[model samples]
Target: MRRAIDWAFRDRRTGAITVAQWPNLPLWLFAGTSLADWILNPPGTVAWALRLIAGASLAWWAIDELLRGVNPWRRFLGAAALAGQALVLATAGP
Candidate 1:
């Protein structure tokens, strides 16, 4: 158990503790907020569907980052998508 835990959370090269295995927190936050808005306010069916798709896409990106690897371009793209989603939600105004 200890060995498995160490392998999962520790950097093999430096032997230091790392949170590198976890997904991007900001991505999770944005998705969570978008989902909450959909649940609480219930936008028009079309808007709600769009929001759901965007949120799911962000989640897929997060999982991809974890499973594949992190890259600066991925971070930038995710942030841009989050911003776009926020803008759309704001302008639409539930």
Candidate 2:
């Protein structure tokens, strides 16, 4: 059990357990755009643009992590995030 846990969560480069990491560039962009969308509440076109940018940034981050994450745990998080985003988009009103 412990070996399996380590196999999934251990950081390849650092050789330490890694469950979380600081926000990377795309994640930072996503946060900034999302915050702007929520707090500024711009008019229709600007709001839509912000939402698009935020979603693209999040998707880029997720894809990056899924393809090149340091550990299985990170990859799983990326896959889950992408799946969640897909679900939201699928169900969102036009």
Q: Give me the overall lDDT of model 2.
A: 0.94
RMSD of 1: 9.9
Q: What is the Cα-based TM-score of model 1?
A: 0.38
Tens-digit lDDT track for model 1 on 1-94? Answer: 9776666556545676665445465456656667667677665885666566656667566455444433444444546665665676678755
Per-residue alpha-carbon lDDT of model 2 for 1-94, expressed as tens digits? Answer: 9999999999999999999999999999999999999999999999999999998899999999999999999999899889988987999898
Q: Which ten residues in a row have the lowest lDDT in candidate 2?
A: 80-89
How does each model score on TM-score? 0.38, 0.91
lDDT of each: 0.58, 0.94
> Highest TM-score among the candidates is held by which one?
2
- Global lDDT of model 1: 0.58
Give stretches of model 2 more than 4 Å off. none
